[model samples]
Structures are given as C-alpha cells and as structure tokens.
Target chain A: MNWTLLLEQTLNGFQFGILLFLLAAGLTLIFGIMDLINLAHGSLYMMGAYFAATLTKWTGSFLLGAILAIPACMAFGMIVEMIAIRTLYTRNHLDQVLATFGLILFFNEFVRLIWGPIGLDIPLPEVLNGSVELFLGIRYPAFRLVIIAVGILVAFLLYLLVSRTKLGMLIRAGASNRQMISALGVNINFLYTIVFGLGAALAGLAGLMAGPIMTVEIGMGEGILIITLVVIVIGGVGSIKGAFVAALLVGLIDTLGRSFLPDILGLFFSNDVADTAAPAISSMLIYLLMALILAIKPQGLFPPRGA
Target chain B: MKGTPRIIFIVILMLGLGVVPLLADYFDEPFYTVMFSRMLILSIGAVSLNLILGFGGMVSFGHAVYLGIGSYMVGIGTMHAVEDGIEWMANGFLQITLAIVFSALTGLVIGAISLRTRGVYFIMITLAFSQMLYFVAVGNERYGGDDGLSLYMRSDFNGLIDITYDNSLYYLNFVILLLSLYLSHRLINSRFGMVIRGAKSNEQRMRAIGFPVFRYQLVAFVIAGTICGIAGVLSANQTEFVNPSVMHWTRSGDLIIMTVLGGLGTLFGPVIGAVAFLFLEEFLSGITEYWQLYFGPMLVLVVIFARGGIDGMLVGLDKWWSRNSTVKNEEID
Candidate 1:
C-alpha cells in the first residue's frame, strides 16, 4: 500500500464525514426541537442541489447559485412544515412516519417530473478547479479543500449561533423540555418553523457542496440520508457537537475500510474472494460501530439530559 | 344480523375470487391467474405486518428485510442444490422452512435490540438494520450483488405439489393465503393475542397487571417476520429471482401503506389493503408513466379525509344503510 494513496483516502473520508455532519446537524435539531420525524428531509437536500444546478446554469456563478439555493430550500422547508408537518407534531410517530414517507414519494416523483430521471453535473468554478500540492508530492483538488474549509466555517458559525444567541437558548430550552418553552411564551410555532428552516438550509448547503463531487440527481439525497441517520444515531440524536464528531468518524472509517480492507485481506485470502468480501464488510463497519455505541450507551453518547 | 351477514359477505367475496379464473376463461383471458397469485403473495406480507403494527403497536419500518431474507434463502439454497445435485436433503420445502426460521431469528435479534427503545427510536433502529442488510446485499458480489440473483428454475415441490402451471400455483397460493387468514384469525382471538392487544392499548397498564409486555411483543414480531418470510419465498418463486430491492425501505413503506389503507387493528384489514393497493397500482401505472404523481396526492387526501381508511368508510356506509332501512321497516310494520 502506498502511503500517498492512504493519505488521500483519509482526506476523502474526512471530507465525506464533514458533509455528513452538515446533514445530520439539521436533522437532529429539527427532530429534537420539534419532535418531528421528517423523512422528507432528504428531499430538501435534493431540491438544493437541483436549485443550485439550475441557478448556476442561468447566472454563470456557482457561488451565487448556492446562495440563492439555500434560501429557496429554507422557504420550501418552512412551507412543508406549516402545511403538513405542523399538524403531525401532535400526532404519534407512526403518523409522522407514514405522512413523511408519502412526502418522500411525492418529492421524488416531482423531482423526476421536473428534472427528468437523468443526473446533472455541477462543474467546479475555474478558480477552484485545479489541484494543490500537499505533503510528499501529493496533489489534492483545490475544490475539495474549499469544501473542507466551508464545512469548518459553517461548523464554527453554527457553534456561535447555538451557544451565543437568545434563540439558541430557546432552542436548547425547547429541545430539553418542549412544554416549558411553550409555557415561557417562546412563540413555539415560529420557533419550530425557524428551526425547520435552519435544518433545511444546512441540508441544502451539504447538497450544494456535494453536487460538485457526487452526481446530482433526484435520488441522490437518499444515499446520504441513510448515512446521516447513522451519524445522528452515533452522535447522540440531539447534539450538534456529537453529530460533527460522529460524522467525521463514520466517514473516515467507511472510506478507509473500503479503500484498504481488500488489500489487507489479500494477505490471507485469494484476490477475487477478498475483493468481493471487502466491500460488504466495509459497508457494515459503521453499523457495527453504531451497534457497539448503543450497546455501551443506550441513550447515545451525548443525549440531552432531559431527552 | 351479526355473524351470518359477516360470514355471507366473506363467503361471497371468496367465491368471487374463486370464480375469477372461470370468468377470465370465458373471456379468453389468462391474466386473472397472475393477478390473483400476486394478490395472494402480497396479502400474506400485509397480514404479517398487521400482526405487529396493528395488534402489537410495533411499527417496524424495516419489515421488508424479512422478505429479502426469505427470497435470498431460496436463491442461495437453489444455487447450492443445483451445484451439488442434492436431492434428499435440499428441496423447496426445506429451503422455505429454513428461510422462515432464519428470518424469525433475525427478527428476534433485531426486535431484542430495537425494542429497548420506543417510538421514533424503534422506527429508526429497524430502518438502520434493514439499510445495513441492503448495503451488505449490494456489496456482496457472490450473491449477484446489485444485479440480483436469478433462478435457472423454480423451486421443485418434489411432486407433493405441482406449482409449474400458473393455475396450480394460483391455487397453491390461495390455499396458503386461506390458511394464513385462518391462522391469523385464531391467533388474534387467543389469550396470547389478548395480551398483545392489551399491551398495544396501554403498555403501562399491562405492566401494572404483571404482564411481561416486551416478551409478548418480541414473540409477535418473530411470528410476523416468519409469516412475511413465507410471503417472500412465494414472491421469489413467482418472479423466479431474488434481489436486495425486496428489502428496500420503499417496499417497507408500501407494506405500511397497505396496512393503513385497509384499516389498522382489523384482522382482515391487511388483506383488503393489499388487494386494493396492488389493483390501484396496476390501474394507475397503466394510465401514466408517473402514476405516483397521482398516487401520492391521493394518499395525502386519504390521510386528511378518511383517517380510518376504506374499511372504515365501508363500515360507516353500512351503519347509514342499516339506520335508513330500520326507519322504513318501522313505518311498514
């Protein structure tokens, strides 16, 4: 195994993990604060990517497209909450699952109708397209570095927003005890909508950044959605910090496992068998990790005290 | 007025299903066999889901995993049997039995772990486990991976039953469906079913009454998984293939839709649901390429307008019809 290849895979894992953090952060917040199970959260991610792709084509600026898409996704998310999800907040989890599942079907089909079934590509801006030299003569794409920088920047901003503001305090209060927040006259409805919109924006940001690296398509949101769920599960469902750490951990383990497991296994098994088994085993690593985490701490690593 | 009318309605419905093939034959059509066979297989799956979701109050979002496991069992068993030319030990019945047992074991393990949490946690955990299975299926190349596994021939029934012919298969499925319906009815009314239902109504109350609610739910989950496994086996045989798609979250969603569309907590709800759902799917798909454009909105409408589902609507209609007739009868008397 080449050291350079290993290093590159490690970076790739970190990048993937950061993207997962963006998605999971929003999901956990909405779930914790609103007590809503929005399975269609993935649809918001899909919409963001699609919106960015379309806007970039029209405006000829990737940055502007992303800027426009974030607000669009937030608006869409708020509308969905008001029209459908608001009623569901008072219902049981089963109703939430069923209704949101319907939303998924609707959104997937709607995207297909509008964008067609084929995938679209979002080219990286020319200024950020080239590779930058890293350690040991290894070159990495500048675009990927930008993605990492953006992820960190967002994480910092999120940290400030959640820890510093009065809204943040309310959010924390709401997540811990919904009744108490309402009793305190927090405009719980407006708070839920804002939280939902914020969650959608985060998911949208993940989608916009992911569009350049991964294929942009109607069903793209679903693959990431599952991983984000895994991240949230491992991270303790209500904590942004936990989501960040778990996302990075999951990303690194998954990427490195897939990249190196076969090579390692080749020492004991035939190349063909090793190749076949590696992928399956690697895909299962995160789940095994999740199970291990839950086994150790059933409430999750950073479960909110009241939760 | 009570049992007789219900029995008559059921008998008429069954007879109507039984005579469909004859009616189709008269019209020189052969599609009824396929439709009925599909209905029978899906009904088995829906009924299995109803046992847990309706009676036990465990809304598993990954119930389709059992179907995948059951189908894969058939594919793997047949692959080995053909390679070794094993006759006495490995056959269709044995394969199906193994599939049911394996799926039940999986259910037991998953239920044990997931049942530790309640509500949203249970849904998410079950979904996560199924997703893991899906990923494993997609990545494992030996089992055909993403392209899925195809059988060279349908499973042999060893002359104990001939399922090669469409009509024979239809009849066989009918027999199994009827048996399942009967078994489910019996199971629901049993003392065990009572405990499960009571647990669903108020778990805390049941616990206060000294019932071990978790064990009862786990048992229900296992039984439900095993029944769905049988459906999966039949599905694989019908399609002559098995794939990871069987365990997809969408498939599980479909099962939930069928259960809700029929009527929650009703023994025969899932059966009606499966039949109506598949029929609607077939009809709608024929009308447009994007049939779900209509189907999705319709589901939303159903949730908004008819929360109790089509069965509930029918019961309401029955009540209205009876009340109106009673007034007229009183005037005549």
Candidate 2:
C-alpha cells in the first residue's frame, strides 16, 4: 500500500477502463439507434484480435495490422447485419437474444476452425516493449499508456461524430424515432448497417488493443461480452455518456477491488478466510454493484432524457 | 379438433421413453438408456425454464445456476459424508431438500431484483448473477475450485428407490418427468397461471386490473428454479460428478435453446426439444468434432425461418392434414 503501488494500480484500472469504454461506446450507440441487442458484438471483438494477430504477423507491423483489421471487422459486421440481424429488428427481444446467442456459438466455432484451438499471442513492438518512468521512481508499461491515449482519442472522436456531424444527427434522430426519420427520406436500413459496422469497428479496436496484453483466441469475446453487457446496464442502456462513466467506474472498482480486498479483509478475518473469500467477492464486486444500482435506480444512473 | 394429434404424439413419445430401459437391456446397449436419462433430466430443467420464459414472459438467462446449485448440494454432501464421516449428509432425501431450499432462495433473490427490470435489462441482470455464482464456484478451493468436485457416491435413499442401478435411475427420471409434465399442465391452466400468462402478454394491463403481477411472476420463477434443482439432483446422480462447467452461462443458453426448439409455452415441448437437441449433438459430433459450426447456424436458421420449433411444426402438419381431408369431403358433397 505504498504511494507508488497505489498510483500504479490506479493507472492500470484507468487503462482497463478505457478498454471497457471502447467496447461500450459502440454497443450503446447500436442499442440506442437500432434498438437491437447484438450479443455477437463480442465475436467482432474476437475477430479483431485474431485479424490483428494474423495481419501483424504477415506485415510485421502492429499499427498496419490494426489499421487493416478495423475495416475487416466492420465489413464482417455489416454482412452479419444484412443476413441475420436485419430480420430481427421487428422480432421480439427474446428472438433477438436467441439468434445472437446462436451467432456467438457460430463465431466461436468458426474462429476455432480458422485459428486452431491454440491461442495466438500478439507481441508488442520494440518501442512499447519497455516501461516508462512517470515520476518519482514509479514506472508503467508503455504499451498500456498507449492504450489509454488511443482510447481517450477515440472517445473524443466518437463524441464529435455523434454530436457534430450529419451522420451523428441522423443517428440521434433514429434513436429517438426510427419511422419518423425513415418517413423523412433517410435510408434507415443502410444507416443501420453503417452504424452496426461502426460498432463492430469500435469493438475491433478494443480487441486489437487487448491483443498484446491478452491471448487472441476463440471465445475470448464471450468473457468480455458479459462484462460489456454489465457496463451497458449500469450506464443506462443506450447512453454514451453513461457508458463512458460506468465503464471507467466498473473497471477501476473491479481492478482495485481484486488487488486490495484480500489484504483489507486480512485485517479483520483470518488469513485463510481472507484468501478464500477475496477472489470470489472481488469477482462479484461489479455484478453486485449492478444489482445495487438497478435496485435503487431501475432506469440506471443516467437514463436517456424522456426515456 | 380436440388437439387429437398432439395427444397422440405425446402418447407415442411417452411410450417410447417408457421402453427405453427395456430396449437398452434387450439390445445390450445401455448407452441409449444413459443418454436418454440425461435427456430426461435436462428436459426437466428446460420445462422449469419454460414456466418462466415461455409462459410467464420472463426470459431468465441464469436458470441453469439452480441446476449447478442442485448438483453441488449432492456433490458437497457426498464429500462431507466420505471425508468427514457424516453419514447423514449422504442421505438422498436430505440432499434433495437442501438443494430445493437453496435453489428456491436463490431464485427468490434473483427474481426479486431482476424482475424489477424489463426486457434486455432483465436478461442481462440474470446473466450477471449467474456469472457471479460461476466465478464464486471457480474461486472456491475447498469444493475443488476451478476443477470442480467428483462425487464419490450417489446419494442413498436407503431402499426407498435404489438409484445406484441404471434401470432404477432411468425409471426414477421417467416418473419425475411425467409428474413434472402433469404439474406444469395443472399449473398453467389454473387461475394463478392465467395471471402469470396475462402479465407476460401485457404487464401494465395486468397491473392496472388489480393483479399482483410481480408476486405471481416471482412465484413462478421460484417454482421453476426448484424444479430445475430436482433435475440437478438427478443430473449429478446420472453424471456422477459436478463441476463449475455445469454453471457456465453457455449451459443456460443451451437450456433456452432446448425450451424454444421444443415449442415455447408448450408443456411437453421441453422434453421433445431436449431429446432432439441431445440426439442432434450426438449425431453431429459422431460425424465431426466441430459440430457447433453446423449447430450454431442451424439455430440461427431456426430463429429466422422456423419460429415454432418441432412441436409447432408437428401441430402445423396435423392442421394441414385435417384441412385437406375436409376439402375432400366438400368436393364429395
């Protein structure tokens, strides 16, 4: 519990929080605009990681691989929307859930077939392979710092695109009223496809960022997908600002809780009790937060105005 | 006109299931019996889920947690009996009671919290709670942690019904399945069932009409979880092992698929769906290890093209045949 250690953990949490925000922003946008639940969004994340891994190896450059993988994931997302997701818009939520659940299964197996059962490891570039001295003898991984910076830049760009651009105007209109916008001559379906692709690209970006730190493997999407879902729920579904705030909160709480809870519990409980209970409790921390939040504010902390 | 075809189909299915044990013995292939027993156990779980999802209009994504709880009750009880010499812990009746109680309590807490939200929120909340339990199970080292625990012995009922034997266990599963189907039929057609169904169709309207909709839904959720717990007990016995894998969120998805494939809101649909799904899994895996590649797309197609599932299709066929016969009568006239 030294100052440097605490500072380092806080930075780690912030870095992790950025990753969650990247996934959540796209998900919230898609949910807001189309009113569709895409459970397979995580598959896109997994695909991005795999694509980045392959592209990186082939090109021998992490930046180029990521640049290529984003569009690839976007195209894949649009294709999925046209084929499977288009019909689900009018269907009930349950059907949408089941269909997306199927897509998850399909994507995982497809990845396994293509990538093999073994996980692919993405090696960081030489420039980011070392640690950076922040200040006062405290150092942080340079790669993680890059992730935070990229995440913040992306978040800023997303805000501009959603609020300042014509497409963003249409997106806002669609979220508020789909038929009204369609009646006004906007190609809502095409717009949906683009928005869906954009969401996929964002998820892909998250996967690409995560690749160097984590293994790129089949079913990687599902593990993070659930957490993303939790983030959306906590953030008040379909609210980007809510998503951003909630994602960071959940990340910091999860990371910090896991790191410090056991030691804190040891002060009161026996060593064995603290050791056994900490992991279980820490793993449950965010979910418990979600439950408490939902109980108190059923519409979530920052539900969309008028919703 | 009286749903004669559906009744006949049910009769045939029941009789076929009834003779599985005897047929397995005659063919000297006990594997079919074991597999069918597993199917029946899962069918029970699916049926419980249908009570909430199909009829009650509550899509609980964590229904399988009760199954895990049910399995662990027996698993941990067996561990205590063997290792700590607690003979009473091995009693099948007590194990089942504890499992039912724990499952009911969990369902109550989950339902109370999740039922407050509607649609996608409910789904995500339920999933989160189950994932919470899953992580807890993965972290508990005393109960074998991530690796799960092996039940050294099945719970003994002391001759009330010896489940150690395959045939007896199979019969027990059959009887329970029959009883559950009967219970579901009675419950769904009752006044209470009407309230739950009404709420599913239109919750606001139900509430406006002075019905305590939340209470009814919570009751249904608890009942469903408890029944799934019974299935869990049988599942643990049948598999002779319990692990964290049983509680995985994917397993809950499997339960949803089975319920939907059989025919949502239909009493006997879960059984049919379970049997068909398990058989399909076995058949596909026999052909290739990467069966999910085929299976996943098939599910997507079912959602897109075939909404009613197997039972719905069967009912549709019967309607078509009866309509054609009436057409012939009109021509003759």
- Tell me the tens digit of each residue's lDDT in model 1 across B232-260: 88888888888899898889989999998
lDDT of each: 0.85, 0.92
List candidate 1 segments past 4 Å from native: A267-272, B1-12, B81-84, B87-90, B329-333
User: Largest DockQ belongs to which candidate?
Assistant: 2
Error of 1 at B311 (Å): 2.1
- TM accuracy, model 1: 0.95
Q: What TM-score does the predicted chain A of each candidate obtain versus native chain A?
A: 0.97, 0.99
- What residue pairs are clashing in model 2? none
lDDT of 1 at A228: 86
TM-score to native of every candidate shown: 0.95, 0.98
lDDT tens digits by residue: candidate 1, A87-110: 778767777778877788788899
Q: List runs of model 2 lying over 4 Å from the truth.
A: B1-4, B331-333
> In order, what DockQ does each candidate have?
0.61, 0.85
